[model samples]
Structures are given as structure tokens and as C-alpha cells.
Target chain A: MTETAVTRPTEIEWHGVSPKYIAVDLIGTAVSALIFTAAATVPYWLIQEPWALIPSAAVLLVHLVVLVLTPRRIRSIRYALRADDLLVRRGIMFTRLVAVPYGRMQLVDVNRGPIARAFGLSELKFVTAAASSNILLPGLPAEEADDLRDRLVALAESRRTGL
Target chain B: MTEPLPPRSDTQRPEEREGLGSPLTEGRGADLAGPLPAGNPRTEGAGFEAQQPQPLQSLATAPLTTSLADGEWHRLHPATPLLRGGIALIAIVGFLITNLRDRFIEGFLPMYRDEDYSGDPVEFLVGEGLLFWALLATLGVVLVVVFFFWLSWRFHTFRITAEIVEVRQGVLMRTNRRARLDRIQGVHIQRPFFARLFGAAKLEIEQAGDDANVQLSYLRGHEADALRRDVLALASGAQRAAAAAAPAAPNGVPGLVEARVQELLAPELDPAEAAAESVVRITPGRLIGSVLLSSGTLSVLAVLAGLGIVSLVTGEPIAVFGALPALLGLGTYLVNRITSGLRYSVAGTRDGLRVGYGLLSTTNDTLPPGRVHSVQLSQGLLWRPFGWWAIRVNRASRSSTNAQQQQTRSLVLPVGTLDDAVRVLELMLPGFDAATVQRAAAAKGGEPDDPFTNSPRRARVLRWFSRRRNGFALLPDVVALRRGWLWRELVLVPLPRVQSVAIRRGPLLRALRLAGVHVHTVAGPISSAIGALDDADAQRFFDEVATGAVRAAGNDSSHRWRSAEAAS
Candidate 1:
């Protein structure tokens, strides 16, 4: 009888992030992981010390687990456009759901990293008066991101309110 | 700080002083060449007015002394030069003269020629018979320093129009900062001990964002209050009314010495000025008791006891001695906390809420309606029996440069009882629901009669002590978060001030079917967050609050409170 997101009949339809986002997340994590391993194992390469391999191997193992979880992480990301706010939900083990009202939005930004742009993906960010309301919705097709940005801008304009 | 300028001119002509003050006239006649840009338009056509046998009373108040909102550039207090950097220059010159007094005596009289020099550069110059050049160089340096101070004072000017308050300053690279009147969060007047000696006060117009605040340092003390009132009046959207009815300087003209003596003797919070007496009376006993009962004091005691136990167990007295420095530091902090709590006052004014504090160097700030973003009332475990609560607020205005000033400014009520707390909240949030706030304050846990949606029993795993007490309520205009069992706390964030709503769940929370909620407001002393709520309730809370926030923001016309009234 316990209520959950799935059981709520009145809950609005939630949209999942693009599947291609998994590649972006994995590639981004792999690049950082490789850099971290290289930095950690520098002593082994410079002094031919065997103990350095322990740290690098441990880092590699962690990265491999993360690589396996990247797809589920992408699938976990969901957003819903309610009547007055844009609701975003993310994270698996540590779940967070944020609702940013259109009126309080100070700035709307659309950015694309090199890899994201290669995959025709863009990340949308919303800036509100409170710095704590750091909301970002990533992994949207470039065209869709642009369209969403324009729609949000218009909505924000119509419902503009002061801080 | 000994009367940096001659007092003769300032004391003689009360009439001329009423126009531009002694400092401005002295600066113009001393060095600056060209005639300044007719800065005082009001004084331009005052020939006939001046000739008439004026009413001394009206002339004393001097409504035209500073037409702040006249849409023209105006210079700051004439003492701005000395207050800014002239004091440093004076100190440097004084130090040089004192250190080289022997050299000077030897060079001039030849009687002390056998005396040993201080081995300074001046000593070497005198020994090498280059005393003339050294004296000339010192004079040159003094002249250059004086010229620069004068130039800076001349360049630093501020202008106030209907919509914006702009200040531009810089001798080389001109810098201009404009704060929109509509965006002004509050106006603060600070009188440091030295500044008060010079009959000056710093007027700061608080604005949002990083480094956005505009400061007009060292304005005439009497004028600072008037200017702040005019600015607040304009910011409240009563520009026309304020321009027509700006309060004339309250007291009639007193001579220079009389005025300074009056200012020095004035109380921290003048009952005459703050028409509505302070809502709470903070007796000396209560102030000291509150400080001693604070959690900080308890921690200090705990550390001391631990040190004593360690010393006894180890049979080493040095253990206690080792903690002396840390204990002294903690003791100093406690003493400071108590001293600063003295002379604190908060009252309601016609324009807004007035809060004044500090003993020697006082600060009086006025926050117009709707400026406060969130309010928090908290009680320590030891304070429970006394029914004491401390109130703090999250406001958009902050002095980013000074962290200490920023912290003290946010605490509207440092300590008070439940009734006093409610009254202070009412001052901040006009027409707030007192009954709901009372219930929120009084509830211990699992109070079915209370309006707040109490956390379910399942949250006990995560918040064993606070499970029943931790909850949130959606009031008519604000979202209230009630938390803590031993240390009770409540936070109220106005619906219009809520920037965003968030719900979070970690692995433990998920297993217990509980979630945490955060109602984002401006960054300040208060944090509007609560944990261990029913998962379903959390979701519903987010949905309803978000929707309510949007509606509240749309309906909010508090920004131009007076303007709305005028329009209707």
C-alpha cells in the first residue's frame, strides 16, 4: 500500500534522457579515469617502482564499475514539465528531484561539450536567484535543446517576477 | 584623528555651512583650479532667498542643504579625503619627523652635533651634509601626497536620479557603479567611532549579486539619515511623496561643537526616532544568561572537563596547561558575543523595520517591506526551560567585503522569548499568521492537532529523536519547516521568495521510505531545509509548494508597496 512515483496516478508523464547520453557520460568518465591513473602511477614509470601499480589498478577497477553503471545512470535521469515549473529527477543510490519555477529563473543557458556536440547533444542549465538551486538538464538533441530554451525563455518572460 | 582640519571656518559661518559645508569649500579653494560644475543647483538662485530675513528655524533644518533626489551629481562629505587615506599620510609624516628629530636638531643648532643618529636615511643625509636635499625631498613627498588626496576627494562623486543611484570614482581609471532604486534591498547607516568624531557616517545602499553594493562613505552624520530615508522612500515607490515631504533635518541648527557633542551623547536607539518602542526588552540578566547557555559555552566546558580528566588520568599537569591558549581564545569569543549583544534594539518605523545595535560604533539599518526572504527561530536545549528563541533572517542584501558585518546583519533578533520571536517575525512579515507560527513553535512531536504534516513512523530509523517533530507545513503565504527535538527550530520562507524546491533521498532514506526537502532562498544565516519526511508527502509537498510559489510571486506587488497603494 506504500505510495511511490510509479503508483501516483496523478503524477505527470516523465521524460527520460536520450540513450546516446550513456556514451557521453562513459567517455567523459573514462578520460578523467585515465588521467587519474596516469597521475597516480607516475612514480612507477619514473622510478620503475612496482608498488605504484597497486593504486593505478585500484583506480582502474573503480572506473570499470562506473563504466558498467553509466547506462543505468543515464536511464535514471528524468524530467517533467509541470504547469508552473520544470521538474528534474536524477541519481540512483542518492536520488534528487528539483522543481525550478519559471518565474524565478534568472538565466537559461544551453551548452555543448566537444563530445556532446559530436553526438548532436546539448545540456540546458537554469539559473535562479538562489545559488543553491543549481539545476542542469543534460543529454538533449541540439535542436530539441534550442527549442526548449526558447520555450522556457518565453514562459519565463510571461511569468517574470522579481527577487 | 585630532581635528584634521581647522575648525575656525566651520564654526563661524553657520549660514554658508548650511549650503555646502566647510569641507567642500576648503577643498575647492585650496588646490583645484577650475570652477566646479555648478554642483549645487539649489544654491545657484538663492540670492534673493538668502537676502530675505529668513526664519532661523527653517534655515536651521535646511531642507535645501542636500537635495538628494534632484537628479544631479553631489560630492561626499568634505572630510572624505582625510577619512579615505589622508590619515595614513599624516601618520607616515609624523613617524618620519619623530624618528629624525635628533638629526634635525643637529643640522639646525650644531649644539647636538655629537649626539648619535638613529641610523636612518635622514641621519646619513645629515652626516653627508645633504640635509637640504633631504628636507626638500620630504616636503615634496608631503605635497604630492596632499595633492593626490585632494584629487581623489574631488573625483569621488555620487548622483541619484529617480530610478538609479550611481557613484563614480578614480583618479586614473574611472569606475562607475549604478544600483537601480527598484533593486535596492535596504539602506544602512554606519557610524564608526572615528567617523563620528568627524561628524560623518557611511551610507551603504545594499544590492543583490556579488560586489553590487554601493557605498557613500563619510557623509555628514545628519545628512546620512535624511539621505537614507529619501532613498528608502524612493525605493518603496513613493518618490513623488518623498521628494515633496522628505523629513527636514529634525533639530534646528546647533553650532559645530554643540552638534558634535549632541551626536556623541545620543543613545544607540533614540526612542523619539523609533516611534514604536522596541518590541522586546533584552535585560542585562537575560543577555548574559543566553550567552552562557549557548551551545558554544557548553562545548567549551566539555573540552575543559576532558582536559581535566586527561590530566588526572595521565598524572601530567602539563595536559591542562597545554589547553590554556585554546580555552583563552574560547573565553574571548564568549565575552565578545555578550558585549556585542548589548544595546540591541528592533522597532517598526513608518518606512520599514528599524534595527540598531553596537555600543561605541553603532549601525542603524532600515529594511523596507518584502526584503526578507526567510526567517528562522531556533532554541538551544538549555534554553528550553526559559522558553528562549533566537531569530535570524535570510535577506538579499549583504556586505560581501566584510564577513563579520554580514553575519551580524542577518541576525534580526539574537535572543528572545516565544512571544517576542512572534512579534519580531510579524515585523519582518507583515500580517503573518501568528497562530500557525505559535503552533509550529510549541509542537514537540506527533501533535496530531497541529497543521504540519508530521513525518511518518517509518522515518524513525533515520531521525530517531526528531522523527515526530521534523515536518513541514504550507501556510497561506509561506512554507514553514519545523525540525529538531532537543534543539527545537523553525524556518519560514515566504512563497514569493522561494527560488526553487528540491527533494532528496539517500540509500538509508530510500530504505526507510523517507525523503528530505529544501526550499531554496537567498544565502544567509538561515537554511530552509528539513529531512526525514514521508516519501509521498515529500513529493506532494514539492508539487504544492512549487505551484504556490509561482502564484505568490505573480501576485506579489510588495516591491512597490506604496506605489500600489497610491495607484489604488
Candidate 2:
């Protein structure tokens, strides 16, 4: 017997994810770098004076480079539902093409942090049986996320029934 | 209902009549039998008639057999002893802590200085002061035990019903927990040295989805064994019943060996050709040489020697003597390796494949094809020249504990050609093609003609003090990628099993547009790294692996659940 493909919508419209996610991640990195810089000063205090700042400056430069590179490297992120699979494509320099089959879907959790709430965005996390199958889809409109979740759940249930 | 009276003369009541017939009337003269003379109306009465019919029918059928309607119910084994012992142990420790406060403080404090001792001499000199404090502490402990006894009686309750086992505890906060008979995974019985001496074993009931384990502390040896046997019997019986009802073969059944054996031994060398194949026997010299060449063991010996030398220079007597035993231990290891190498052998069997190796602790492991997760063949710089490769099989149950995990190494073969490796792989993983192995091997050394081969696009390749080549891809054509550092190699792990993938950019890498990728697998804490790559390439590989992982994981999850259901 030939297998029939289950069709689903190609594109889902979700609200734009909260800007706070990016801001928080960026700020956290910056804070950590600052702490590292402060810690590095101890050696300078002990022995080296002018050279300690050199190492600290190098660290700051590296941090700045990372900060500048990440956003540029993250290409247009989009998720689409095909007949049998959910596909997510992200990254610029190193493009990632991830496809999670509907039948394998276990649990879908939606969380909105304080920052996400401020920006009217939410995060969608999908967990499967294998530990590595966990995925975090950040920065989506709440309504769109809800719709996506419902559609995904329906698709998963249908597949489970061997539709 | 109404009470009925027997038909009798006015002189006698029903209670007074004992025998089948009235004693006063039976075989008597006219005077005694006068009351029984013609047409007694009492005998014809309805009450007398009803009683006579009922009693005669019941007696003729059978003696009236009546049993107690309110019989005793089955009571479960008590949890009292376990609770009492646990409470007693805790109480004793608490008592020691509280009552010995002064002595404990004195012992813990650094050697008391004369200048620090400022207390009155008279109080310190009087032993009565100490005695008074000890008595007061003893009274407090007694009160605590009394309270605990009351709590234990009130809170501790356990029951093993026909369907499940339950434990309800807590005096003030009452919590009740029950484990279904079906959900229990395994019963682990542990006996510590002291517990063994006291003839008690600790039982832990392991279940799925629960972080805390249900423990039955200090069960008598016989009782623990009996409980374990009952639980196992119940579990097995239920499984067998389910299997009988289901038409299909259960998943994860031990009998998969038949199919696996067929798959594993399908490729057979011609009898004559097999005999012609030369076996690499480990001679005494070779064994000793290999042991001496082992970098790990040699380094350990070197460290000890260095320590001995330092100690000798410092004129330490014990350190000088320690060197002799260390050398002797190293000698013993060498001999053991030699003996083990001599016995090492790998051969094919109709059932599966068996590899036997070891000297004192000889081990024989049979790898039926179905249990083999993955097969790997590798050649180090030295082995490459000799055209020899080591083969290893990844199995499931073999990964759980240390004994099996350690035995996994004994399954490895020292001398095997590429063809042999291909044959083994084909047997283990049915669909594996020889071309894939060739391509993978070619990709590792940066061969040009290999279509899947990728260059080591490193951000930095420093040949001087530090030689690090970072960005490299092996087996780029394969859907599930496996790569590792030069120092630590991981083989045949599917992408979906990777728990995390991290991409790190160092200062030099940032300048050179390069990064390092580390992939974490689920075996344990330690993760494998595929280091030193250009940033763009690393990110692309990361994304590809992640995508593949997601899909593979989805497939595995559904398959696993289906298999588990089938097993049940």
C-alpha cells in the first residue's frame, strides 16, 4: 500500500518576538565581560600595571566583535509546516535546516518571561523523547504561537492515529 | 418473621424435647401416653405443621451448616519495624549530639591554651557540675524519644494490596504515596557491611518519572527476599499474560537473538579461505612490548620514579622503600598484559560473534547483531603502517554499568584489515556499505578525490609551541556526523543522541573568522569536541547537525514508545 502525505499550512503568521530577548542576552554577555575585566585587574594590582589593561582591552575587543557578529550571522529565522514535518531554518554564515517530524512530537511548552511580556513576545519550546530533540523557538507573537501550537498538536495527533 | 412453637403436650415445651420423639410419650404405658391419645388439636396447628416440615427437611438433606458471615480481611505486611529502626537510629544520633555538647566542644576546639582558660577553677574542679548537666540532657532525650514514639505510632502506615503498594507518612504534614504494580521498573536490594552483619537489607523501589525512590529500610533478610520474589513473580506473570493476549512478538524480547544471529553470521568466508587467514597471536615479547609502550602506564611509572628521586634527595626513609613495591607492581602489570595478549582470540559462531580475552579475569562476550548499536574501526599512526585496525561494537545494556562497560574493551580486536572491518560493519549494521567506510577514512586524511571530504579550515594552524588544527569535517556525506579531538576520539554516535552543541569563538578565532564546536553525547558528563574551524563553516555544520538531530530524535521517540507498548 502506498503511504499518503498529510498536508499542512506552509507559513504561519506569528507576532514578532520580544526585542527584550536580544537585549537581555546582549546585556548578560556584557555584564559577564565586565566582571571578567574587573577580575583580571587583580593581576595588574599585584604586579603588572599598564599591561593588565592591555589584556582587559583585548577581552573587551573580543566581546565587541562577538556582539557585532552574532546578529549579522543570524539570518532570517522562519518555521514552516510541511505535510509530514516541521522545518526551521536559521543562521547566515552556517545555515541550519532542522526538521522535526509531527509524529515524534512529545510536548510543546510556551513560556513568556518578564522581558518577553514587555515586548509582547513569547517562546516556544518543543521536547521529544531524546534529550537532544529539545528546541527553543524564541521571539514569537503570543497569538501566532498559540495558533502554531494548536496546529502542531492537531497534526501530531492525526499522525499518531496513522492518518 | 415470626417465632414458631413445636406441637407438644401442655406439660412439655419445645426446649425440653431432646430426642427424635418425646421421651414422656415414646414406648410408654396408657397413663404416660394419655396426652398423645386420639385427635390432639395441637398437633394439627399451623405453627406445629410449619416447624415439623422445616426441621425434618433440613435434617434429611444435611446437618444445617452455618459459617460466620463476617470473616477477617487480608491485612498487609506492617511498616512498623522499618519505621521504628529508622527513627531509633536518628534518635540515637540526635541524643549523642545534644547530650555530649560539652565533651564535643572540648574535643573540637584546638588545644586549649592556659591563657584562654578564664573560667572559675572551683566550678571546673567540681565533677558534680558535669554530672548535673549530663542528667539534665538525659531527661531531655527521654522526652524526645517519648514524642517520637507517639509520632511513629500515629504517622507510619504501609500496605501492600493485591494491585499496588503504598506508604503513608508524616505526623503533622501527612503525605501518602502509592506505586502501581505495573510501573515498578526494578527492585534494588542493598546491604551495607553493618546491615549485612545485622541480617537486614535496604530495599529501593525504582520507578519511572519519579525523582525520589520508595525505600523500605532494614527489612529482615528472609522477608526482603520473599517480598522481592513476590513482586518479580507478579510482574513477570502480568507480562506473560499480556504477551499471550497479543498476537505480535513483543518488542525488546530476549529472543531477538535469532534474527540478529542470522544477520551477523550471514557473511561467511569459505572454509578453506578462512583457515588460510592468518591469526595474529600475541607472543610474550609482543605483550611486554605493548605494555611498556603504553603511554598511560609508562607515565604513571615515571611519576612514581620522580617522586622517589625527590624523596631520596630529601633523605626520607619511607619514600626510598616505597619505590621497590611500585616497581614490583609495574612488573606484575606487564606480566598480566603478556598473559592476556596470549589468550586474546576472536572468532565467528553460528549464533553470533564471540571475543575472548584476559589473563586472570578472562571474559567472553557474545555480540548478537541486533544488540550492536554501532560498529567502529580505527587505526592510529603506528597501526596505520601495519595495515591493522581495532574494531569496537556499541551495545545497549553494555553501557549502563561499569562491569559491562569495561568488558566492552575486551570485544575490541587488535589486528584487522579494512576488508575485515567492512565485513564486521555489514554484519552489525545490515545496510552499511563498504564505500561509506572508504569515504569516511579518506575524508579523515583530507584526500582530494573523496566527494564528501572537507579541508581543515582552521582559524589558526600554529606549528611552533602549540600545533592546533581546528575546523575539520569527516564523513560530510553521512546524515549523522561524528568528529572528535585528536586526543579523545568518539565513534558512531548519532546526532540525535547529542544533548548539546556549543560553538565558541576565541580571540584569535574571532580575528581569523574561526570558531570551535563541542558536541555533548548522553553517555555521561564528558563531552567530545570537534575543535578549530572557521566561524562560518562551524556554524553551518552546527546547524546541519542540529537539524539532523531533531529529525532523528523524533523518529527515535515514536519508535521507543511503540516498542515499550509492544513489550508491555
Identify the leading candidate in terms of lDDT.
1
True contacts kept of 1: 0.52
lDDT of 2 by residue, B49-134 (tens): 22121221222222111110011111222434434465577788899789756555666784652344336442364444675676
User: Cα lDDT for residue B179, model 2?
Assistant: 50
Give the alpha carbon lDDT tens digit for every residue of B124-220 in model 1: 8868999898789878987997788777787777866555576767766556565556667788888887788888999998876545578999799
The whole-model lDDT of each prediction reads 0.76, 0.45
- In the predicted model 1, the residue pairs found to clash are none
Quote each prediction's TM-score. Answer: 0.84, 0.44
Q: What's model 1's TM-score?
A: 0.84
- Native-to-model Cα distance after best TM-score fit, residue A90 in candidate 1, in Å: 1.7
